[model samples]
Target: MPSLHEFATWEPLLRLLRTGNAGNLAVPGGHVAGQISHYGWSLPLQRRIPRPGQAAQVEDVQDEFDAVQRVQGALADIGADTISFTAEISPTGRSVLHLISPGPAVEPGIGGPHPGSLILVEDSVPEPWRRLPDPVPGAVPAPSVDLASLERTLRERVPGAVGATEAEIAATEARLGVALPDELKVLYRVTRARWEDWGEDHAVAERVFTAVGCELFPLDDLYIADASSRPCPWRFGAREAVVTPPDAAVQGLVGSPGWIAFGDNGGGDRIAVDLTPGPRGHTGQIIMLSHEDNIGAGLLADSLSQLVLEGRGPGRRGRHGDGPPAVARVNIRSLDSVRAAAHAGLEVLSLGVWEGAPFSLAPVTGLPRLRTLTAYPGTLADPMEIAELTVLEFLELGPEDWRVLVDAGAVPRGLSAAAIEVHGSRHPLQVVALANELLTLWDRPPITRTIVEGHLEPGV
Candidate 1:
C-alpha cells in the first residue's frame, strides 16, 4: 500500500497529465485539472483516433485506464472517497501537484470538474423540506370507499393467499408510530405479499402484482415516506418551495409524515396512502411520489380500493398549481432583470451568467419572503447589497463576491446554509479559505486541505 503522499502513488497519473497537456504547460500560468474516484477519472487527456473500419474499445484507451486505476488503488488502500488535483508543469517538466480531499460536510460535485457544495450549517435543511402538511380539519374518506368490498375483492382475486395476522398488523403500526390506514390493512390481510410465502414461484408473484395493480411491499417493508427519505443537495433543494393550491387534492410537499408508503408503481415511484389530505382531498387518498421529482406528489386514486379496482384516478395531476412563482432566475435567457422578477412572493433568487451589465439587488431587498440568493461570480453590481436581505437562509456566491461579504462582516447571520460557487481553474485552497471565513462566522468546522508535492520528468 503506497502512501498517497509518495511520488510513486501519483507518478503514472502525473506523467499522463504532463504528456496530454504538454502544449499548455509550455505557456505561462497554464495548468490541467480534473477529479478521480474509485470508479473513473475526468482528466483532460486526448483521445486516440481508432483505425478506419473499427469501433473504439477499452483497449484503445488502455494507457489512460491503467493510469487512473493506479491512483484508484491507492485511494482504496487509504480509504478516501475521491480526489481532485491541479498540476502546473514548467517547460522543464518540474511539476507541482495540489491534491484536494472533499472534507466531511461537503457534497461531491456530480460528474464534472466543479468543486462540490460546502455545507455551512450542520444538519440544517431547506425550508420546503422542513414544511409539514397543513392540517385539513374537514377531510374525510371519499364516498366511494368500502372496506368490506375491498377485502372481499382481494380474497377472491388471490384465493388461498396467506394473510397477516392482527398481531402482525399491530406490530407494524408500533414500529412506524402510525396506524395503518384501514384500506391498506384490508389489502395486506388478503395477502401479506412476502417472498417466503410464495417461495420461488414467479407466477404467484405475477398474480399478486395483477391482483394488487402495483408491486406490493411485504408488511415488514412498509415505511413512512417522509421528507428525509428523499434527500437532495442543498444547492438545488434550497430553490424549491412547497405550494399546495386551494383546489389541489394532494398537498405539495417534499414529503409528508403522513405518507405511508405501501407499494411501488413498477417504475421506482412510491405509492403511499396520504393521511394528511389537502383542503379538497380525502384523508385516505392514494398518491405517488415520483423518483425523478424533488418536490410534490401526484394524486393517483381516491382510495386503495379505487386503485386496485379501476386502476386509475379521476385525473392524474400534480399537487401544485400556477400559484405565484416563488423562484426566479436572472440570466441571459431568464427574466431580463431583477425588477422584472420582483414580487413579495419570490423566495429564491438566482443570478446567473449574463451578457448585460451587472444588476443591483435593490428591487428585491425588502421582499418579505426572499430566503435564498445565489449569484454567479461577478453578476452582482454590488455584493454589499446582500446585507439588506436580512432573512436569507441559504446564500451561494462566487469567491470574490463572498470575499466582499466576509470582509465587510456582512455574511448574512441568518443564513442556515451557504455554498461557494467556483468557476474556471481557481485553486481549491483559495475556495477553502473563503468558505472557512463564512463558516467561522457561524462557528462551524473549517475545511481541511492536504498538500502533496511531487515532480514529473519532462516528457520526450
Candidate 2:
C-alpha cells in the first residue's frame, strides 16, 4: 500500500490538475486546491461535455475519476479521514504540493476546499443542546386516548401477530431506565414486531408497519431520543435556539430524555413517544424527530392510541412563533447591513461576502443573547470589535481577522468552539498556523501539518 505522503500517491492527481487547469497555473500566484478522503474527493477539475443527444457518464471524466480513486486508495491504506492540498505549477510544469492533515480536533469541511474547523473546547456542546425540557407538572394523556380501542385495532389488523411477554416488556423498561408508557406497552403486547416471530417475512413486516402506522422497532431496540443522540458540528449547531412557545404542544428542545423512540416514519425520521410535553400538550403525545433538523421535534399525534386508530393526530404543530428572527446573515443578498438584523433576540450573526466598505461589528456589540458570529474574509472593518461580544461561544473568522483578535489578546475566552473560514487558494499550512494559535489560547491540542514535498512533470 502506498503511503498518503508518497509522491506516487498524489502524482497522478497532480498531473491531471495541471493538465486541466493549465491556464490557471500559468498565471502569477495561481494555484489549484481540493480535498480528498477515503470516501470521495472534491477536485476543481472540469468535466468533459457529453456528445449531442447523449447523456454524460463517468467515462466522460474517467481519467479524473481514476486519478482520484488512486489517491482515495492511499488515503484508505493510511487510515486518514481527509486531507486538503494546494498545488502551484509554473508555466514550465514544475509544481509544489502541500498536503494538510487536520489533526484530531477539526471537522472536515463539507463539499468544498475548506480548512475545516478548529475545536477550541473539547467535548463542549452548544447552549440549546445543554437545555433540558421544562417540567410539565400536571401533564396527562390526552382525552382522545383509548387503550382498549387501540389494542382492539392492532389485534384486528395484525390478527396472527405475536405479542410480547410481560417478562420481555419488563426487561425493556429496565434497560431503558424508565417505565414504558402504557399505550406503548399495549402496542408491543399486541405485536412484539420481531422479525423472527414472522419467520423473516417481508409481507408480515409491511403489514405490521401499516397497522402500527410506522416502521416499528423490536422491543429491544427502543431507546431514549435524547439530545446526545443527535450530534451536530459546533459551527452550525451553536446558531440554533430552543424556543417553546406558550401554546406549543411539543417543547422545542434539541432532544428530550422523555422521547422514547419506538419507530421510524419510513423516511428516516424517528417516531417517538414524548414523555415531556409543552404547556398545552398531553404527557404521552407522539412526536417526530426529523433527521434533517437538529433543534426540535414535530408533534405527530396527541397519543400513540390516537395515531394507530385514526391514522393521524391534530396535524403539525408550529414550533416557533413569528417573533424576531434568531439568526441573521448580512451579505449582498441578505440583510444589507448589521443594524437591520440587530435585535435583543438575535443569537447568530454572520457576515458574508461584501463588495462595499468593510462593516463594523458595533451594531451588535452588547447583544446579550448573541453567541455565534462568523465573518467572511475582509468583510469586517474592525475585527477588534469582536472583543465587545463577551458572550460568544462560537466564532469563525478568516485567518486575517482572527489574527487581529489573537494579536490583541482579545480572542473571546467564552468561545467553546471556533473555525477558520478559508476562501480562495490560501495555503493550508497558514490556516493550520492560525488554527494552532487559536487552540493554544484555550490550551487545546494543536492541529498537526504533514508537509509532503512532491514535484510533478509538466503534464505527466
Candidate 3:
C-alpha cells in the first residue's frame, strides 16, 4: 500500500480499461481505472445489475454511464452549458490516475449534453497520460473546469459569509412572514457566487424546469460564502423533487437572479415556483402564469425580471463574451418592493407581486450599490424618487410606473438600456411618452407609438 505522504488529493490514481482489451495490468489497492476510447459510455444501463458474468459487461456499461451522469448533473446544476465524458477504471494499488479518460464537451440539444470525455486505462502508467479517441459521430470533447481551483479562488476572493444558525434561520422565517424551502436554505448556507461557464446551463435548466409549468423561484438569495461547511440551502429544495422527472410540471424552484423564459411552449398553464408567504409576494417567488395569468401583476413582474436579465446594454451580464453589456430586459408587474430593495444596496433583488395589484413605489434609501431593478404592471408608491438612483443602469418598471418616469422630467440617469411590457395602463399618454423617448419597448409596435404620441411632442 502507498504511504499517506505519497498521495495529494483523495480519490487519486484514476485509470481506464477497455471492455474487450486483454492488456490487463495488475494494480495496487489505491489505484482506480477509467475506460477511454471507442465505447461511448452507455449511460442508460447504469444502476441496473446484470446476471453474474454478464454483470461485468452490463455493469461496466452502466457504471460508466453513472459516472457520466453524476458529473453531467453536477455540471448542469452549476450551469455549465455543455459537458461530456468517456469511461475507464483505476488500478488496484495506486490511488491516483488509476481509471480515467479525457472527458469531452457535450453540447445540449444534441442527444442531450454529453458528459466530459475520459479514458479508463491500465494502472501501470506512473506519469499522467493523454490519449485521443477516434472521432465518434456524436462524441464531443467536454470543457474542463478546475472545480477545486475554482472553489479555492472563490474562497480567496470573496469575504466569508456568515450562515444563519438554526434558531436564527427560524427567526428570519417568522419575521419575513414566509417559510423557505430547505433546499434554498442549503444554497444560502453554501455560496451564491455564479460559477464560471455554468450560467448558460443554469439558465437552460431554469427554462426546462419552467417550461414544464413548475413554479420557479430565484435561488440567488441563498448563496453565501460561509456555505462550504454547511449543507446547501438550494439542495434542500432540490432533494424534495430530485426524483421528479426533469420535464415534470412540478419541479422544485430555483431562486437565482436573472430569471429567463426560454422557447415559447410553457407546459400548458401550470404554476411554476410557489412563493406563497415569502418576501417576494403571493405568486410564490418567481413564477410563470397561464396566458390569463400572464396579465396578472405577478406575471408582469416575472416577465419584467426575465426581460431585464436578457437585453443588451450597460447592466445586463450579456452573452459569454464580447456580445455587449447586455442589460436585463424585463416585463414587470410592479416596482414597489424593488424600489425599496434597491436602496438597500442589493444588486440582485427578486421581484414578486402578481399582476393587477395596486401600484406603489416606496422609497428605497441608501442602497447606493443597487444596479438593477424590475417590476410588473402594478402601481407605483413614489415614482419620482426613481430618478435619485444615479448609479441605476437597468430599470424595468411596471406599466403604471411609466407615468412616474414621464412625470420625473428627464429619463432616469444612467439608464442607457431597458426592457418592459406596458399592458392595460390607465394612461395612454404615459405609455406613448415611454415608447417615444425612454425605453426601446418591443411588445408594442413602434407604429402604434406614433399614433398615440404623434399629436404631442416627444416629451409631453
Candidate 4:
C-alpha cells in the first residue's frame, strides 16, 4: 500500500477510478481467485511490489497472451495506435512497474502506422479550466448551454464530443447535414468547427455529476485515424486482412469512415459513426470495423454519450504482477533501457532501428531467462552468442553468419524458428540446408528443393 507520492505523474490516470473484485472463470491454478478490475483506470507499465519474504508470483505465457489480446480489444474501441496497462497492486490499487508502451500489437506481420490522437483531459487539464472566461456578476456562467439540446445532440448526432463553439459545431452539423448528439455540448464545448474538432477548452467541470450515484466520466479523449498513413496487418486466427485506405471504397472502413472516427486499438480497427448514413448504418449510430472485422460493420453504440458512460463502467481493483515482463521493446540507441529491462527479468526483447554500426548480444545475455529475441542483424557484431541460451525457442532475426549459423554449430540447439532472409545472396543452398536441419529438429517436413538452371538438381 504505497502512498500517492510514490507514483509517477500519471497518477491522475487512475483518479476516481472505481475498483472491486469479481469471481471469474477459474484459471488453471484451480483457484477461484478474486478478479480485480478498474472501471475508469488503465495504464501501460510493468511494476513490481516488494514482497519482503514471499515468492514473486509471475504469470505464465498463456496469461500474458490472454492479457495482451484483451487489451487489444479495448484499444480498438478508442481508435488508438497503442495500449498501456498496469498490474502491480499498490495500496490504492494496482501499481505498475514497467508497462508504458503505446505501440502497435505484435503479430506475424508488421503493425500499421498508428495515425490517431490520444488526449486525457482530467489529468492534463484539471477543473476550473485554464481560460474560464470570468464569471459574470449576475447571470449564471455559461448557462446559455442548453442541457436537453446538448443531451439530444450526444445521443442522436455523434458518439459524443465537446470543446468547440456552438457556431462551429452548427457549421459542421450543417455541412454534414447531420446534427450531432447533445451529450457533447452537455460535456464540454466543441473544440473546433469541423465535425471531428474538439473545443480548445477540453476540460470538464468538477463535481458535475453529483446527481448520479456514480459520476459520469466524459468522453474526453479522441483518436481519429489519418488516411495518409499506411495500414498494418490484422491477424485473427489463421486469416489476415488489410483495412481500407482513407479514400477507397466502403465509405465506413478505416481511413475514410464517413462518420467521425473516435476510437482505435492500435491494431487495424476503429469505432466510428456515420455522418453520411448508408444502408449499413444511420447517422450518429456507432459502428466498428477493421481489417479483421470487415464483415462486422454494423451498429455498435447508439450515441457518443452511451459509448463513453457504458464503456467507462467500473471493474475490480487489484491486479497481481505475477506475470513475467513478456515484451520489452526499446530503441537501439537506448542501450541503458535495454539493459535495465534485461535486469528486470524481461522474457521477450524487441530492439532497434538499426544502423550500419556494430552491436553485440552481450548486454542481453545477462538476462537470466530470455526466450525470444527480435532485432536487426546488421547491427550485431556477434550474434554468434545466441547459441549460448539454453531456453531460446525463437530468434527473430537471421544471424550475421546466416550462411552457416546452423552448419557451423552457432545456432542454439533449442532455437526452433528463425526468419532467415537471404533474398539475393550467392549461396541459397546453405540456407536451404540450414532450414532442413532446423525443420528436422522440430520434427517437421524439410524444404522442397528446386534446381538452379546449371546447378545440382533440386535436392540432389
Candidate 5:
C-alpha cells in the first residue's frame, strides 16, 4: 500500500505509464521540482532494470563513503534536498524516498563507485506541500468569475445542471467570511458551482468544472493525471496518480471528486493507496482531502466504517493491522452526490467544513449510512436533525459548533452508539450540556477534553 506521501509522489511515474512503456524508475518524494538535494547519479549512468529479488547492492566502501559524504553536504547546502520517488513498476515503494545528487560525487577509485549504490547524506525534515501561504496581507486576490457570472452561464449555458443563484452564493460567503479560492471561483463560474457535473462536453465541461485536464502519464504503478487548462498544472504537484482503465474505465472507479480510480496492468506493477492511520492497514485504503460541501456526509461514512473496524470505546484505536476500512477527510456538497458515492462502494468519507452551513446536522438526516462526522470551528444553526443515527460511532464536532448542537432539540434526544467529541468552540456551558447528554444517553459517552478546550477551554 502507498502512504499519503507515496500516493502523491507517484503521479509523475503514473503519468509516464500512459505512454505504454513499463520500466523501473525512481521518483523523489518531498523535494520540490528543480530542487537541489544530495547530488549523485548512477556510476554506469544507465537506467536500471532490477530483476526479481536481485537487490541493488553496494560494491565499494571507499566510493560509497565518498558518495554518502558528498550527498550529505549537498543536502545541508540545499537545506533539505533529499528526494523521495515512487518507483514506476515497484509496489513495495522499497526505495521511494531517495536523495538526488545535488552535484556529483567523484571519489578517485577505492572501488570507483559501482553502479546502483545509493549514497546517503544528511536527510532534512521535509516540509509538507503547503497551499500557498494564506495570500499575504493586502495582496490582490487572483481574479476569478463571480457567483453571478456562474449563475448567468449556467442559466444561459448548461441549463440542466443544478445550481445555486448569486444570492445563494453571497449568503454562503457571508456566512463563512473567507472568500472562495480562485480555482473554486473559476469552477463555479463555468460549471454553475457544481463540481461533479460534467456539463455539455463530458470532456470539455469536466475541465471547467474540475479545474483538471486530461493529460496523463505513468510512473511506477501510479499515473499522474493533470488538468491542462489551469495555470498551476501541479495541483499540489502531480495532483493524483492511478492505475485504472483509460478514460472509458475511469468513470467506474472515480467515486467522487477527491478519489481517483485505477486498474491492474497485468504484471508490470501492483498499486496500493494507504490512508490507514497506522503501519499495517495503511496500504489497503485510499487517501483523500475533505471539503465542506459534503464533509458531514463524508464524516458519517468515515465514522461508520471506523465503528465497524474499531468497535466501541477503548477499542476505537486498536492495534496496527486489525482494523476496519481506512478513511481520510473529504468534502460532500450534495445529498445526491453522497448517495451516489455510497452506492459506489465508498466505505469512508472525510470532510472539513463550517458548523452552520446545514452540513453539521444535515448529514444525520441526509446521509443515512454515515458513521463518523468530523468538523472544525464555526457557528451552526441546527443540530437536532441527526439525533437518531444508530450506526454512527464517531462524531468530531468542533468546539464552536457544540453549543448549537446542544441547544438543538434533536441531538440530545436521539443520541446512541457513537462517541461524540466536541472540539474547540466558544461555549463551555453548552459543551458541558452536550457532553452531559452523551453521558446520560449512551452507555459510553464519547466526549473528551479536546472538545472542551477547542471550545470552552481557553489557551487550547
Candidate 6:
C-alpha cells in the first residue's frame, strides 16, 4: 500500500487529511483526484474527455507535481476572481506545525516530522528545514507525557547538550518580570537551558534555545527588534495585523502584546506566551505566530502542557518518503488512452464509472510493470483478457467480471486485494457462492483479499 506521501496525485487529499481546511483538490488528469474535507475522501472517478476544442482546456503535465504546479498557475491568473489560490497554511498542521506567515516563501523541509512543512496555497513560509548533523537514534512515544522521563530522554539522546541548573532557572525568572510556567520551569530544570547544533544544509543551525525550534533566550544573544528580526508574514486570503515601526527591542514583531519570547524555530518564528491576561485571553496561553493568512499570535495551545503533549504525542510524526512517480487519472473514453499509458509504463490503472464506456484491456497485456488493474469491465469490453496480466495484485470490479475472468482461466496470480462490487440481478448469496466456486479454481488461494461492495469476504 502507498503511504500518504507517495501519491503525488493525492497530494491535496493528503493535505486535506493533514490539515482539515476543507477544499477540492485534483489535477485535470484522470490519474488521481478527489473531493475531501473533515468528512472523508470521495474520488472524482470520471472526467469527461474533451474532444477537439469543446470548452475544456488541455494540459500536458509531467505528473502530479507538475499537475499541481500547472493547476496553481492556472488558478493564479492576473485579475482572476473566485479562482485564486490561498497562501494560508494551517499552523497546527499534521505532525509538523508549519507557520505560514506572509513573508519569504519557505522551502519544504526534509526528513521526517518537523515544522515548516505547509501547503503551497499560503504565501508565508517559515525558516528552512533543520536536522541534527547526526541525530541520536531513538524515537520517543508521546501518547501522554511523563515530564521527568521525557526530560531524561532528551538528555540521553543528545548527551552533548548542557543541562540547566536550579540557579540558572531562578536567575532567568528574575530577569524576566513573570515567573516561568511551572511546566516550563520544571522542563528547564531537568534538561539543558539550551542546545546548539549544526545541520547538513545550515552552516550554523540553531533554534532560540530548544531543539524543537527557537533557541532559549540567553543561550543565544537577545537582539533588538529590527528588519533582521521580524518576518513579513504573507497575508494572502487574510488581513493579519503587522507591527509597523516595531519596538527597538520587542520580542516578536506581531505576536502577543505582553508575551515573553521564549524560543524560535530558527525560521524567524517564535514560540512565546502572554504572561499578562486580558478579558479575551488568559495567562499561560501558548501563543505563536500564524503560518497561514494574516492571523497573528493565534492561540496554539491553551498551556505549555498542551504544547508538550502535541509535540511529542505518539504516532503524530510526519511521514517521509522519496515518493514514487505520481500518476494522473486519465479519461478512459476508449481503450486508446489506456493503450498509450501502458505503452508509456503505466503500472496501475483504475477505470471507474465504466458503466457505459468503450473499455478493453486486450491492447496492453504485455506491459512490464502493469501490476494493478481496476475496472467495471463490461460497457464495451470483454473481461476475459484480464488473465493476460501476469503481475496483477489489486483489482476492483463486479462478480460477473470475476466470473468472466475465471471461466476463461484468466485470473491473475497472487492477487492480494480486490473489491468486487456485486449488484444488478445478482443476489448476495449468489455472488458469494460464485466467489467461493472461483476459489476452487486456484491451486492454493488466488488472491489474499476480496470484498463484495462495502463488506469483506475471504479469498477474493
lDDT leader: 2
Clashes of 2: 0
lDDT of each: 0.84, 0.86, 0.32, 0.39, 0.30, 0.39
Per-residue error for 2 in candidate 3, Å, reads 81
Window of ten residues with lowest summed lDDT in model 3: 449-458
TM-score for each model: 0.91, 0.93, 0.23, 0.31, 0.22, 0.29
Judge candidate 1 against the unseen true structure and give its global Cα lDDT, from 0 to 1: 0.84
TM-score of 1: 0.91
Q: 1-460, model 1: which lDDT tens digit per residue?
A: 5677677787787887888888877777887778899877788888988889988998888878887888888888889978887777787767687777767666766564455666767888999989988999999998878899888888888999999999999999999999998999999889999998999688998899889888899999999999999999888899998887889888888898899998888899888999998888899999988899998888889998888887855337654566557888989898899998899999999999898899999999989999999999889999999999988999989888888877788788888888888877676567767766776787766666666666666554
Expressed as tens digits, the lDDT of each residue in 271-344 for candidate 4 is 55544433322345445555553232444444454444444222111221344344566664654355555654
Kindly list the per-residue Cα lDDT of model 2 for residues 378-422, writing each as its tens digit.
999999899899899999898888888899998889988898888
Q: Given candidate 1, what's the lDDT at residue 383?
A: 96
Error of 6 at 392 (Å): 1.4
Count of backbone clashes, every candidate in sequence: 0, 0, 158, 60, 68, 36
As a TM-score, model 4 comes out at 0.31
What TM-score does prediction 6 earn? 0.29
**Model 1 CA lDDT for position 109:** 66
Q: Pick the candidate with the highest TM-score.
A: 2
Candidate 5: 10-residue stretch with minimal lDDT = 451-460
- After TM-score superposition, the amount by which residue 267's alpha carbon in candidate 1 deviates from its true location, in angstroms, is 2.4
What local lDDT does model 5 show for residue 446? Answer: 28
RMSD of each: 2.6, 2.3, 29.2, 24.4, 27.9, 24.5
Q: CA shift at 142, candidate 2, in angstroms?
A: 0.9
Better of 1 and 5 by lDDT: 1
